[model samples]
Target: PEIKSWIDTVLYDSACDSQPLKDKFRDQLGIALEASLNPRRKKTVTENLPKGMKKLTAYGNLVCNA
Candidate 1:
């Protein structure tokens, strides 16, 4: 029967090696998935830094803390 033949074909294809398909999928989506899963936050700069002597102390503290 045509239905039986189709089922057999489906089973045969499903049993065949699928590594190439998996590799292609990974190659296409790996970077995007990795970025989505482990996103990097951009470091923002302080726009309103202390103007004078406090600036040096602030900078020193920032550097030391980091």
Candidate 2:
């Protein structure tokens, strides 16, 4: 929800640009990761393909690459 909220804020704010919104998101993500025990790896792998498999896979790949 945080991600979606941030996206909406950025999308609706005419005076704001991507870099600022991205920086905010990065800060939030860092905080979240730091709060977790193992920030580098997922706890479990999904056995079955999720709904919207193509989009889900693409998003996972993008995160891994990033």
For model 2, where is the 10-residue window of minimal lDDT? 30-39
Backbone clash pairs for candidate 2 read: none
Compose the digit string of candidate 2's lDDT tens values, residues 1-66. Answer: 456443432223333435665566657653211121232444333445455433223224421212
lDDT of 1 at 4: 35
Tell me the tens digit of each residue's lDDT in model 1 across 1-66. Answer: 334322321211333446665455456544211112111233433556544322223223332222
Cα-based lDDT at residue 41, candidate 1: 34
Q: What TM-score would every model get versus the actual structure?
A: 0.21, 0.20
Best by TM-score: 1
Supply the TM-score for candidate 2. Answer: 0.20
Alpha carbon lDDT of residue 46, candidate 1? 51
RMSD of each: 16.9, 13.5
